[model samples]
Target: MGDQSDKGQHPANSPTPYAPYAPYRRPGRRPYSVRMTTGGSGIAHGFPHLDTVRAALAALFRRLSHDTVSTFPTSVLPVDVAFDDTEDVHLGAQRIARAVVHQLHLPDARIVITFREMEHAATVELTAGPEYFVELNDRFRRHRKDIGAALAHEVTHVWLHRLDLSFPGTRDNEILTDTAAAYLGAGWLLLDAYREHGPFSQKLGYLTPEEFGYVLAKRADFFDEDPAPWFTSPQAYDAYTAGRARARQDARRPPLAGAGWAARLRYAKDRRAAQDPRRTAGPVAGPGDGYAFEPAAGTGAPLRVSFPCPTCWQRIRVPVRGHLQARCGLCKTLLDCDT
Candidate 1:
């Protein structure tokens, strides 16, 4: 997103995102970034839902606060969600649902789990409730193993509902729920549920496999936890690897001080252009990696650099003066930038 939009588009005091931060909403909106592929054959492979996912992360930090977010340092363990084939189906389902609710820190959220033939993996009734009703696809009764994944998603909907944190449309709200689950711990089940083989595929939630991996990787990096060894699906593991590369790339973007030599070289040239008194007096578009330079605010004010925080994806605007440290208002991650 080589953003060249005017800064005025984003009102300084406005809560809603506009201009550079609203990537998914910028292009006259997109038709539900990914569809629910219960059959799993059409499982999206990459990061189309990235913008909403990033926004969701920011929202979690904004709503829950950094201290509250830090409370979930551990991902849900595999044993907690296990379902034995010989066990009573209803007992197993309830057990897994309780585990997911506990992991989400929703002790008061009673999620009653049931099964039915549904086009989607699961659905949750999001009303004012200490008790929420959830319906899992009947397929999980036989498949058994994936009951954990479906419950995790539906339970998270209840969690988001209670917090009153959501996006406008159904598609974006679903993406938020998935991102919240993964980032708060318990979303790795959604990623691990994804499996693709000849004539067989299955994925849960609105996010693509890679998006889930990306969120999970973000959580893992912050908590110093590794989830790769827990993946049972080869395809899910591959998506996680690809997603990790994308997450790592965020820290390597220009102006962050850790940017690669090539990126630093390019950013330096863009910085030069912005500083040139004779240069065209407007915003200069950088590469697609979400960094750009704007002209000085006044005659002598320094030109500013705007970029996304690798942790929460919130846009940060800093002056052109070199070698400064900045802290993101959201997520509270400190950065050493040679701006």
Candidate 2:
């Protein structure tokens, strides 16, 4: 059922986070200190592809594994007090989450924490009003490490709910939520919370442990912060390693383009990249079989040719011209071009 706790309210005293508010912000919503610049090669770091995200995670975990031998590094936020059976860590997590939301200057947002016997570890009761509530499973009282992650997930719902953002469907919405939690921050906690040892294990988040690693790695790369010191769970580390392998496998095999699933995949890619100003919105084409029509230097409709890369086979489009080299941004492969 529900985990009962005496500390249901926000902690009276909590240390302020370092750099509580900084330059980074969500795309198109404002507070982005600078726009990411993209070259003609369409290479930039703002809005990233799935494969791009995967590669970043692989690189991060490799570094983390090398740095840790016996104990976790001391740099991560501490939550040992929450681990006590008598203490409720939810209040502390709530304070931390509120600080994050405050950075965005979001208004009057209130989150009421409650416990229930729900199918999910936690669920948010989103509403149109300024105050919303979340229910957590009772098991979290014993699994203190998961408090931050659980609150992060519910807080993510609160953030997204306020924005009223549109998605293709519920699954896509959940994906975006997971991506936001990792990208905006709080991802490291989610990854650290993942545990699978003998009969005791807990994972509380929308994304799979692997997916969490991918986004967390990407965020870590953006901020230049090393999270290896913060990871305390061996099983969480294992999940990241496994995710890295999967990312590599996925990178080797690019999706085939056709009028069927290929077209649908392209649509999804566009949706993913739409909010990213660093990405260029090219004409929607059918894989590599057709040309993306572009307006000519003159008034006439100019012809643009697109083709697949020789290495990873990802489609690349450039205006129809003569001999030049086109770089595949996804895989960084050079293609001999005649478009």
How does candidate 1 score on lDDT? 0.79
Superposing every Cα of model 1 onto the true structure, what RMSD results? 13.9
Could you give the C-alpha RMSD of every candidate to the true structure, in order shown?
Answer: 13.9, 14.6
Off by over 4 Å in 1: 1-40, 297-300
Candidate 2 wrong stretches, greater than 4 Å: 1-90, 103-105, 242-339
lDDT of every predicted structure (CA atoms): 0.79, 0.48
lDDT score, candidate 2, position 265? 58
Provide the TM-score for each candidate, comma-separated: 0.85, 0.53
- What would the per-residue lDDT of candidate 2 be over residues 3-77, giving only the tens digit for each residue? 233434343464322111111222333110101111233222122345433333332233323222112222235
Error of 1 at 53 (Å): 1.4
Clashing pairs in 1: none
How do the residues 22-45 of candidate 1 rate in per-residue lDDT, one tens digit apiece? Answer: 112123322222224755356777
lDDT at residue 338 of model 2 (Cα atoms): 38
